[model samples]
Target: MRSAHRAPRRLTRRHLLGLGGIAAAGVAGLAVQQLRSGQAPAEANTSPGRAAASGAPSPSAAAGPQVVAKGGGTVPYRPGRTILGSYLALEGKAFTESIALRRRQTGRDQRIVHVFYDWTDTLPARIAGLPAGATPLVSWRGSAYSDITSGGSDARIARAARQLKRQGRPLLLRWGWEMNGDWYPWGAARNDKDPGAYVECWRRIHDIFAEEKAKNVSWVWSPNWNSAPVAGWNSFEALYPGDRYVDWVGVSGYNLHRETPDALFGPIYRAFSARKPLMITEVGSMDRGGRTKADWITLFAQWVEAHPAVGGVVWFDTDTHPGYAEKWRIDTDADSLAAYVAMAKSVRFSG
Candidate 1:
C-alpha cells in the first residue's frame, strides 16, 4: 500500500544552520586534493601507503567482516552477512554520544554511520572523528536535474568529488535518494515529471566522479519503497540509472503503520536483489495502533536473515518533527532498546 504521507525531508547540518541562521562550518583541516587535468586516481589497491593515506585500516588492524569489495574500488559487499548501521542526527555532541550509547547497549560497533549533505555543503571535518572502523554513508541531496545535466552545477559537483576522494577510505555515496517520491526537488514529480531527466542527472554526477577518479566511493542508488504518485512513469525501473552507474541498490522503507519488514521491502527485494547488493539505506518503525515496536524489530531481524542478498540496514534512529507522529529512535524504552540490542548482537548482522 502507498503511504498517505510522503517521507519527511531529513534535517541535515546545512538545514539546521539555515534554519537557525548560523554560519556554515568551515572545512577546517579537511583539504581537497587537486585533480590532474584528465587523470583519475588508480583503482583501489591494498598497498600499505595507500591504506595509510586513505585512513583505511592498516593490515595490523583487527579485521572484522570486510565492507570493501574484493577487487578494491567497490563497496564492501559480504554475501550471507548483513551490516547494521544507523543515522543519528548530527547535532553537536549528540552524534557521538548516541553512537557510544548504542555500542554500550548492543556490545557491537555500528559498521556504518549515515549522514545527509546538501549539494553545496562541504564534507564536514567532523567525519574524521567517527568511531574507529565505521564507514560514513553520505546521503547527498542534489539540485534540479536540468541544472546538473546542463553543466550548471559542474564546479560544485567536482568540488564535492574532490573532497570525497580526499577522504581516502571506502564510503557509500547516495545521491538524489527517494526520487520515486514527490517530496524532494530532485524527485520525478518536481522535475517536470520526466524520469529520463533523473537518469541523465544521475549519470552526469557519476561521470564527474569517475573523471575525478573518486574510486573509493560506492554509488548507492536508492528510492522510497513506494512511489508517491504511484504511476507507471515514477516506477522504480523508470527512475533507475542503470547498473553501470550504481554500485549498490537501496530503498528507504519505514514502518509507519503495522507493516512487517517483508511487507515494507519484499517487492523491492524481488525486483532488484539480483542486479546488485541491496541495502535498506533508511529504515525505522514506530509503535502504531496495537502493535509493539519491539515485536516489529524482532520481525525485521528475521526478515533480514531470510533475505541473504540484503548486505546492510541503516536505522533512522532519530526523533523527527512532531507533525509526523513518529519517534524513530530505537532506544525509546526498555523493551524497544532490548529488541534492538538483540538484533545488533545477532550473528546474522556480523558483517
Candidate 2:
C-alpha cells in the first residue's frame, strides 16, 4: 500500500545497527513526514524488482506458496547450503563458548545463532557480538503465548519489529513457537483448544511487524512433534496460520526414544514442504539405547542433504534434558563431537 525505498543491503548486524540501531534514528524524521503523507515504509514492498518489471506472477499471486530468504525479502533457500546454526543458551550473555568451540572445531563458524526477547524488551548488542559470519535468529515471546493482546502489547511487538527492520540485514524471527504442543502455556490446547485463537494470535503478531514495515524478518512457524499418544492429529494442521503468513515451516523435534531424523521429522517435513521452506529449527538426537549421538548426527546430516525442501538446521545446542539420560550436548559422547564437525564440514552452509 506504500511506495518502497530500499535500505542499503548488507549482511552484518553491526554494520546495519551502526546505521541507526532499532529506533532508526537516522530515518525517523523522514519517517514522520512519510507517515503524515499517508505513505507506508519501503520495507513493505520487498519482492525482487524483476517480478514487477517482467510482469511475471509472484509466488503469492501464482503458486500461493512462499519460499523467501528472510520474511519478505527475495533471497531464496538453497537446500544443501542452508545455514548451520545453534542456540546454546537462552540467556544472551552465555553463548560465547558455543560460538568459540564451533569456530575451533570446524575451522569455520556458525552462520546464525538463536536468541530470545521477552515482551518487555530485547538485547540487540548480544546478537551484534556474534562471530563475523554469524547472525541472530530471535524469538519474541511474551509472558503467555496464548494471551491475544491489548493495545499496548501490540505496540511492544511493533517496537521490536521496527528495531529489527532497522538492522537492515535479513533476520529470522520465531514468534509464538511450538503452539501445537501442550507444554508451553502459549500452546493452542492451553488456550481452550481453540485453533482460531492460536491463529489469531500469530497473525496479530505478524500484522504488527507488517504495519511497522519490518520486512527484514523471516517468520519461522515452528511446532513441536506430536508426542501425545492420541490427540496429536487434531491440532497440527489446525494451528498452521496458512502459507501467506508464514516464511518457513520449522519443527522442534528431538530424538527421545531411539529415533532417526526421518522418524522424528518426516511428518512435519511432509506436511509443509510442498508450500514453504522447511527447517529443523530445534533438533537433537538423544543419546539412548545402545545408539550413539554420532550415529544420529550422521543420519540427520544425510537426511538434510537428501531433503531438498529442508532449508536450514538449527540444533538445540543446549544439553538440558526432557527425561532423557545423556546430556544432548554434541560433545558429551566419545567421537560424537568429531562426527558433528565432520557433518558440518561435509555440507555447504550459506548465510
Candidate 3:
C-alpha cells in the first residue's frame, strides 16, 4: 500500500482523454457548475436517491482481514491464488474473524474485504475517519438514491475526497458499481433513464475527486451481468463511461444462469479486453437446488483458469442481497472453502 500524504500529481487532460470513449459522453463542466450553485433537491421523486443507510441495518465492525497480515507493505496475495473474501459490513469484526479462521483452515492466503457504504449515510462520515496511510476500497452508493447525482451532488463528494486525500493510501474508489444493471439504486435499467446523464454525473464526481488532489486513488468502473436479459439490459459495456476514467473494469456475476461459467466468462472477458485486467468483482454459485457444495467449487476453479484476464474475484458471502437463485449461504460448503484457499495462493494482484 502507498502512503496517502504524498504530494498530489495532476492527471493531465490529455492523459484522462486517452483513457477511452470518454469525449463522446461530454463530461466537462457539467458536475462542477452544479456544485458551485449548491442546488438542493426540491422534490424527491419515487425513483430519486434515498438518505444514508435508511433501510439497511447498522453494520457491526466484526469483520477484519481474513488472512492476518504476516508483515506490513505486502500481505500474501498473488494471481491464481483463490481470493477468499466477502462483502463485509464495516462494523462486524467477529463475523470477519470467524470467516478468517475458516479460510485459514483451507490454507487460503488472500482476503479482500468489501464495504458497501451508503453514499448519504456513509460517504461524509466514513471518509472523515480514514486513517493515515489507509485508502480504503470503498463501494459507494449502495441501496440508496441519495448518492446518485444527476448534476448537483459534487460539493459533498469533494469534501469526501479531500478527507480521503489526507488518508494517504491510493484509494480504490468504486462508485455506483453495477450501475448498468437494474438491481440497485444507481442502475440504468429502468425508467426513461439516460446513460448520458449517468456518464455526465460520473465525470463530475471524478472531476471533483481530481480537483481535491485525491491522487492516491484509482477509479474502478463496474456493472452487473444482466441475466434474463431485458430489452436495454443486454450488456454493461453499452453504458461504460469511457476508458479514460476507469482504471479497472469489472462485472458482478454468479454461476446460476443457464449459461455455464465456461460459456459465460469468455465473452465478458473479450468485451472488456478494450480495458486491460478484468474481474468478476462479485460472484457466487446460485440456483443448483440441493446441489452439493463440491460442484460449485469445481466450477469456480474451472472458471478462473478459463478466463486469464479475470485478475481477481470477491465472493459475496452474506445472507443478504440474494441474486437470481440466492446462494449467499453456500459458505458452508467445504469443497468451496478448499477451492478458495487453493486459488488465493496462486492469483493475486502484485502490480
Candidate 4:
C-alpha cells in the first residue's frame, strides 16, 4: 500500500487536479453546498459532486512504499497490484482474532478487513481492534433503510458517524448498502416505502456525518449487481445520492451463476468506474464447472489487469446464505483455495 500524501513532484495538470480539487471540487462542491446549505427536505433533492486500521503504522510513519487500503482514508490510484481483501469471521470468536487468523493462514497481508456493524455496535472500538495493519471496511446495515428518511434513527446514526470520527483515522464505512435490491428489508424490495426514500435517507445520513465533521470516513455507496427484478423500485441513478455525497463506489457482485466478472458486473463497473474509483466490495465465485470457482478467480485477475478503475477487491468468504443457493467461500476445497492463494502471491494483489 502507498500513502496518497507525497511531496509535490513536478506539477502537472493532473497534479493540479489532485491538489485540493480545483476540478473535482467543482462538481462535489455543487452538491455539497446545495445539500448542506439547508435546502428543505423536499427541495434538497439533487445530484452530488464527488481505512484502516489499527495501532500499526500511521500513513506518515511510512515514507517508503504507498499502501493502498480500503475503509481507511482515501487512497491514491497506483495502477499496480490491486488490493486483496476478505470478509473474515468465525462464529463465537472475536472479530479481530478471527480475521487475523484467516489472514495469516494465507501468508498474506490483506489490505482490508471486512466486518458488519449493526445499529447497536460501536464503530471505533471495533475498527481499532483489527490486526495491526488491516483497514476496517464496515458494512453498516440498519434493519430498515427508511430509518434516515423517517427521522427515527438519526441520533443513532449520528453517534455512529461521531464514533467513526472520534477514531481519528481512516475507516471504510458502508451504510445501508445494496439498497438497489429488494431481498433485504432495508433494500428496495421491502422497507424502503417510497422509491426516493433510499436516496433521501442516504443523503441525510451523510449530511449528519458531515455536520459532525467526521472526515476520517470513506463513505462507500454500494449497490447490488442484479437489476430491480422487482417492480416499483428505482434504478442505480435514482438511488445514487450523487458524487459529492460519495467517496468511493462499491458493488456487491457474485458469480452465483458461474459467470465471469465482466459478464456479471461489467455494466455497472463500466458505468461507475469512469466516474469514481471502484471496489468489488463483496464478490465470490460458487462451486460449479469442475473448477468454476478457480476459473472465476483466474478470469477476475485478468479483468483487474485490464481495468485500472478497479481499486480493490474483497472476496465474500461466507457460505451461501439461504436465498443465494451457492457456496461463495473460496476455502471450500483445496483447488479453490489454491487458486486464491496463487493470486494472493502474484503481482496482481497489493500487499
Best by lDDT: 1
lDDT string for model 4 (1-351, tens) is 011111122322221111110122232343345346653111111221110100112223334333223222354344555777877544345556656666666786667778765556665544545566667787876556555677888888788888877766577788877676544566665763465777788888889988888877887888765444333354566567887888777877665433345544555655566466677888876575566566557667767776766777888765423233345667777767877887777776764
**Relative to the true structure, how large is the alpha-carbon lDDT of every model?**
0.68, 0.58, 0.47, 0.60
Better by TM-score, candidate 4 or 1: 1
lDDT of 2 at 14: 20
Please list the residue runs of candidate 2 whose C-alpha ends up more than 4 Å from where it truly belongs after superposition: 1-75, 90-94, 123-126, 142-146, 149-152, 227-234, 289-291, 320-326, 348-351
State the lDDT of candidate 2 residue by residue for 41-61, as single tens digits.
Answer: 212111111111111112333
Per-residue lDDT over 25-64 for candidate 3, one digit per residue giving the tens place of the 0 to 100 score: 1112322333356621111111211111111122234632
Model 4: residue 111 alpha-carbon error in angstroms: 1.1
Please state the error at residue 64 of candidate 1 in Å.
Answer: 32
Ranking by lDDT: 1, 4, 2, 3
The local lDDT score (0 to 100) that residue 171 gets in candidate 1 is 89
Give the least accurate 10-residue stretch of model 4, judged by summed lDDT.
48-57
Name the regions of candidate 3 deviating beyond 4 angstroms. Answer: 1-84, 89-96, 124-136, 142-150, 227-229, 232-235, 287-292, 320-330, 347-351
Candidate 2 Cα lDDT to native: 0.58
For model 4, the stretches where C-alpha displacement exceeds 4 angstroms are 1-76, 91-101, 143-146, 191-193, 230-233, 319-327
Best prediction by TM-score: 1
- Candidate 1, 214-243: lDDT as tens digits: 888899998876666666678887888987
